[model samples]
Target: MRIKTKGFKKRTSVDEALKILLSHTPLPSIEEIGISRGLNRVLACDILANIDVPPFDRAAMDGYAVRAEDTFGASQTNPIYLKVAGEVKIGEAKEIEVKPNEAIKIATGAPLPKGANAVLMYEYTRELDEEIEVLKPVTPGKNVSFKGEDVKKGEILLKKGRILKPHDIGLLASFGIEKIKVYRRAKVGIISTGDELVNLGEKLSEGKIYESNSYMLASLVKTSNSIPERKGIVKDNKEEIKKAIKEALSNDVIIITGGTSVGKRDLVPEIIAEIGKILVHGISLRPGEPTGFGVIEDKIIFMLPGNPVACFVAFETLIRPMLQKMQGLSLMAYSHYLVAKGILKRKIPSEIGRRDFVRVKFDGKYVEPIRVSGAGILSTLVRADGFVIVPENLEGFEEGEEVEVRLFHNYFPAP
Candidate 1:
């Protein structure tokens, strides 16, 4: 095929592009999974308690089950005696009725026997071989965990769209819930394209470099709690790029890095337009202007710039939210990053119409910007701690201005 080169007639703003992308995001399907594997998974439906937690009245402490009236006026000076009915260990189901003036030894978590209205702690009672002396009195229902006290039957335990945590799973287990309905993990396909790219572990030619975009994109997908399928590297040829995209349609989202700009080898946009609809082709964002997205057969397709830094920026600004939406998570949630406010140590320049993601390091006191002219400098991302976003409405931030920094990594260096 003949090569063609073109220029962007118009570019969309970062906000508008993101709006278009999210409007086309499809809802994730639901699947039944065991509670053991539900951590971090989104619930598809509200979890209603089918049965009350602690199913029956049980002992909350190691004590003797008795009637509250029988322990009245019992103290160290004058003790009341009761005949020992039987012993109830934890998880035992023996039926031992506490008759008048009768006490039963009950272990913690053991079911309270019939006719027992309270429990007297062992510390306040003296066991005298078949007869126990009550030194203190307990009110009705004391030291007893009532049925449905923790969770009531037919009550909403957890709401829909909630991200399951370790404690949430434990709560479900307490209710004897072995399996739950959760949204299925979105599968993302990542494809890197370029004739000058070579895979790792292979000999590199003079003009070729090892491909790294797919690996980085795959890791970003994993961070969003989605499955990533690396489609391998494809040359700049139109047929190869088209074929790879066609195969990646099996995934819920397809991310194609490189070959998205308005150049002779940038054939991805043209091909996607031929096969489907291009929602947005160019964005007004620094380091990621070539970022775009489209749809084919209901599967969302993302066109990311080949430059490593540009790829990273586009993923954070655009694709991350899309993945969160796909997995039934809130788009505004940034659980992986820690947000902090710091004063700028120096000024950063930017155009009025474009948004800029300036990488910066925080020294507990001031935020220092890491200067880089090009988007291909991957080392800048590693050297910097986090990034500061300058919105399109502002020209830039001046020195000593307080700005919010989103720390991608856990370690925040102190001054």
Candidate 2:
């Protein structure tokens, strides 16, 4: 899987390229992390409950614990009365027994006393000195949460490869799971190449642009729950680029922006072919046609475009999914990305045999496309709300046509 000296003439489809890249990428390693810090981390193995949730049969309502038979035939017109026993407080293990014709005042979540089979809510009864009146009858086990009712001991609570949420953390804590095994986050090394590029805080000279793709890619990696190692800037020289690539190979994934296009300084593909294998040199996609991918020493390398907007699109569509795959997530889970439908404000022209991602501003009712010829226009991405994809087989979208828009924000505009 190496690129020839003549370069790639036929571009690989987006789906086929992703299949090849993922087939080579392996699941990340596992580590034992404290449950307190497990948010967004993928579980490495199935998590079984070691103990029953709630731990015991407890009260589900604030009421009197009594035998269901005692309240039989009791009603508002003609009520039954019982002797009041001691009160039961929550978290108390003190033993208290209920005798026939007797009731114990129990609070919500308080354990039911021995000889008690049901709870009569306080609303259904009233106290008269040393006696309690039951206006309603309760069946056995009514308002009582039996032991192991919420979660039985040894029950599988969470499955492997599941992304942990706040509720999952609480459940683990409930079972006294202080630490858990989770897949280690993929460490991605971001390298920005080209002598024409300058880092932030440096004044831009003629024919130089401030480096933004590295920072953009870093944020993208962070949002995907991965570690981003910004390798700073590198010149287009083969030795310098090769040295940086070698250094970045230590990470689990390598991402190089710039030097991926067909030009004299575009040496990323050539250098990668020399050190390792270039699995994909180009993809059939608009705004990111120069996007490439390869492997160096078993680590996957993504060759992204230099333009900030193109870089952002390529990362979100291609690299982000790859990162998720490496962390043990299934392709089905990838569909959870925020997507909404909106009416197109205008027609979007596209060429056949190439997929296009057009940035659009969705103002609840319609999605207006941001028209820009240069892929380097970064402001359009900032001002736009989301993007709409046009398939390679279609020409474009018609005005007022409903289309699916992948949102940058998690929420859709209110109607």
For lDDT, the strongest prediction is 1
**Cα error of candidate 2 at position 334, Å:** 7.1
Kindly state the number of residue pairs that clash in model 2. Answer: 0
Identify the runs in model 2 with alpha carbons over 4 angstroms from their true place. Answer: 1-8, 332-336, 411-415
TM-score of each: 0.94, 0.93
Residue-level lDDT of model 1, residues 1-415, one tens digit each, is 2213445668899889989999999877889999999998999999999998779999999989999899999999999999999989998998789999999999999999999988889999998988999999999999999999998899999999898889999999888899999889989999999989899999998999999999998988887888899999999998988899999999999999998888876899889988998898889988899889999998999999999999998988898888878777788634457888999999988889899989999987799999735799999999888888888999899999999888867732210
Q: Against the unseen true structure, what C-alpha lDDT does each candidate score?
A: 0.88, 0.86
Q: How many clashes would you count in candidate 1?
A: 0
Q: List the residue pairs that clash in candidate 2.
A: none
Task: Tell me how many clashing residue pairs each candidate has.
Answer: 0, 0
Candidate 1 stretches with Cα past 4 Å from truth are 1-6, 333-335, 411-415
Residue lDDT tens for model 2, 170-254: 9899899999999899899999998898989999899998888898889878878899999999998999999999999889999
